[model samples]
Target: MNEIIQLNILQFSLIYLLLILVLILMKKSKISQSKLLLLGTFRMSLQLVLAGFILTAIFENPHPLFTIAYVAAMVIFSITRILRKNPWLNSSFRWSVSLSLTLTGLFILGYFTQIVIGVSLFNPQYTIPLAGMIIGNAMTGITLALKTFHESLTSGRNRMETLLNLGASPKQILLPDVNRALETALLPTMNSMLGMGIIALPGMMTGQILSGTSPSTAILYQIAIMVAITAAVCLAVFCSLHFGYRSLYNQRNQLNLPR
Candidate 1:
């Protein structure tokens, strides 16, 4: 295959033209969030540019500590985002989320890099990108689960109160919500898996192909990464909900959720 064609700065700038189409559609539709969209786009571009520089330096150096530190930062940032999105939380709930994400994110990252991919845990080339994908998905999964869990409890509070008064155990009353949250958390990953390849080439696969990787090789890596992402999302969400729901009650099994 010929070497991958590189896009010059001018050529890359042309891609921004698509944004004008988006702006026009938003204006026509009278969308109030156009400013938010523009702000998000700007932030995304700036953050990615910064990340590109950092990643370039890290890749050139290739140290274990750099990769480890990067992974730690990812987990910390993920937890921070989750917490920021959810301001109303108790100590137990906070601890649960923090521990669940940290433990599961690290655990899955190790397993995927060392076991699945047979790469060193500190190999920045593999670990850094893979960690970003795994940890980001875990963060997303937990966030969705938390949102669904809260909404479910909020909507079903009356039924929950009746069940509690009727002597139902906290676990019994909360199991459905926990299950619902897990389902909601896993739906996006599951749906993506269902439509992959046939419906659309996922980002990773498309990037690999564009970089001149053989189709078979790209396909294999894409499949492996998708499986890893799904596993990480499942384990992280499961652990977060399993331990997190308990934080909603005390030792006496009395419900104590945020108002």
Candidate 2:
């Protein structure tokens, strides 16, 4: 194995110049995101610094219960973020989206960690990072799907009602919106796949190579991760939309979405 290059605090401190440059450019461009950009960078740095220590502890003492607890916390945080993104949501929609993301994300992460990587169930080295990647993608997938679905239905309510009055079933009325939402949710993933090598080397592969893993080994890991991410996104969107559309109605079968 090769030794990885280490970065000094000086080198790390230099990276902040990028943030300064971004803030300055945003101010000059009148983008109005200077505060947001600064806060985002600060928040990310704080979280990652804390996470570095927490993850080190977890790695040092890898227990199944601890791993499960950490993963649960991650999913809960993700669900909370998703809910924040889709406010004015009904109770049913609230629960369904959380369930869909949780179930799909955990299942895919489990399979990738245990079967694909052939690692122990609670191996922090495999579980934490892999779960992070899977959960992040699933989060984005559900967010896009929910946003598109809600916007489509609300914007096209008259058309949907027309179809319903025309004697179409709820599923039939919402099918186009569902399809459009699913497509919008998955489009980025599809494009990433199309441009994987030619456009950019993905994060996981690049990180692995930087950490001394062979290029071939890193590439294989990246491929497996991409496949898992795509599958997880598809499953999360499908599950969310499948149950979500139904939740838009009351027991009387009338449209009862949250205003």
RMSD of each: 1.1, 1.3
Best by lDDT: 1
Backbone N/Cα/C clashes per model: 0, 0
Candidate 2 — which residues are off by over 4 angstroms?
none
Each prediction's TM-score against the native? 0.97, 0.96
lDDT of 2 by residue, 1-259 (tens): 7899799999988999888788788889889988788788889999999989989999898888888888888999999999999996788778888999999998998899888788886888899888899999999998998888888877888887887778777777777888899999999998899999788999999999898999999989888999999999999988888888788776665776555
Q: Which stretches of candidate 1 lie over 4 Å from their true place?
A: none
Report the CA-based lDDT of candidate 1 relative to the real structure. Answer: 0.88
Clashing pairs in 2: none
Against the correct fold, how does model 1 do in TM-score?
0.97
Each candidate's lDDT (Cα)?
Answer: 0.88, 0.87
